[model samples]
Target: MANLSLDSDELLLPRDVVAVDVPASWGGEVSHQLTFAGPLGPILALPGRRTRWLFLARWDTRPHTPPPDVRYWRDRVPAPTAHWVVRPGDALPLVSVIRCAIRTVRP
Candidate 1:
């Protein structure tokens, strides 16, 4: 929703990963995207509700390739953040950690 400030600690280097804490109401799984224009410049998205989210960290594969973790979010998950780094030879799409919850909490 806003520009992702890239600090020294949050620097997304090559082959690294970061997770974004999305809200349950968002109904993730529609592949949400986190993009960086330049050095924490302009972060953009479709600006609409989605059914999914993606994790760019595990670019090689999704759902199965990466650990079972990044696929979903914890109930007390943190806030969403963007990550970017230079890939030596391949291209990896932006990724976002989709939030999920147990049906017991449904209103």
Candidate 2:
């Protein structure tokens, strides 16, 4: 959903592909701070293909420290709070696009 307007300008080409620039040559999670102008909240990318990234934190900036939330990402944990899957890409924009599409259809 996004605009479906193929304007090319609406394209979600992020500033970087992998989210964060780090020293992990082996390829790994990188945190990207996306301050959505709307209220969708901040996205933490444990990078992956498709909808792999989950909601890491709300817009409040209070760390998501719940054991369940942390456990879901325990397979790989680091200070960056971002993980990767398949390759590094922006996942939040994808989610936002989907949400926008759904809203258009539902409303």
lDDT of each: 0.28, 0.27
- Candidate 1 structure lDDT: 0.28
Task: State how far residue 26 of model 2 sits from its true place (Å).
Answer: 26
- Candidate 1 error regions (>4 Å): 1-15, 29-92, 95-107
What's the CA RMSD for each of the models? 14.1, 14.7
> In candidate 2, what are the lDDT values of residues 1-107, reduced to their tens digit?
12111122221222221122122321122222232323232233433232234332212222333221122222223333343232322223333332332233333
lDDT, candidate 1, residue 86? 24
Give the number of colliding residue pairs in candidate 1.
Answer: 11
Local accuracy of candidate 1 as per-residue lDDT tens digits, 21-104: 223333232222222221221211212254222222222334433222223322222224423222222433334222222122
TM per candidate comes to: 0.20, 0.19
